[model samples]
Target: TFKYVDTDHDGVMVKGELAAVFDYLDVDHDGKLSYAEYTKYDGASAESQLTHDVFNHFDTNKDGFLQRTEYVDTLFSQMDHNGDGQVTRHDYDHFFTNVVHHEMHQGHNGR
Candidate 1:
């Protein structure tokens, strides 16, 4: 999930991109992602829920706070959609776009 969002794969999800993801999930615009904000991004669909699930999974192992490895690994798994251990900007953009749309939809529905 982090890899999908983290295009540079620098081991940390950037504020700009992370903020985008948060905006998508934080339907209420509360400026932070609570469990509910996180849940809004999750679902049964792979495209919709993969990144969010991976984020949550990583968070659980390390105090529910995401460090660089957790961020990178989550993103790496997402960008490496084919599981070939590499990623391109196309993958990152695609995933990010999806998340943004998903978040917008959630916000509309929540309202």
Candidate 2:
């Protein structure tokens, strides 16, 4: 995971490397992120067509953008089981595993 962000392999995530991630996410290259682009997962595990619902969940204010307040606060809150406003490695591991498992279960059931 760290390696994904640290493209230089120097154990550091410089601004350029991180910017590349953002650019990749912005498929249209318009420099603005739409909910559709932001949640478009390219993994072939499943159709993942339901991911747009995640944008609606995060966009509590009906705005077209997923503001940091809603995205960071709500998402981290879900992952931060202890409610300490921070997600530890343990929290991330469990949260990620559960998310993957849930997605897989849903995919199997849906298909």
lDDT scores of the candidates, listed in order? 0.55, 0.58
Model 2, range 1-111, lDDT digits (tens) per residue? 435645667644444554565567678776645776675534412235445545555666887865555555565676668776545556666755776457656755986
Worst 10 residues of 2 by lDDT: 41-50
Each candidate structure's TM-score, on Cα atoms with residue i matched to residue i, is 0.37, 0.45
- Deviation (Å) of 88 in candidate 1: 1.0
Task: Provide the lDDT at 78 for model 2.
Answer: 67
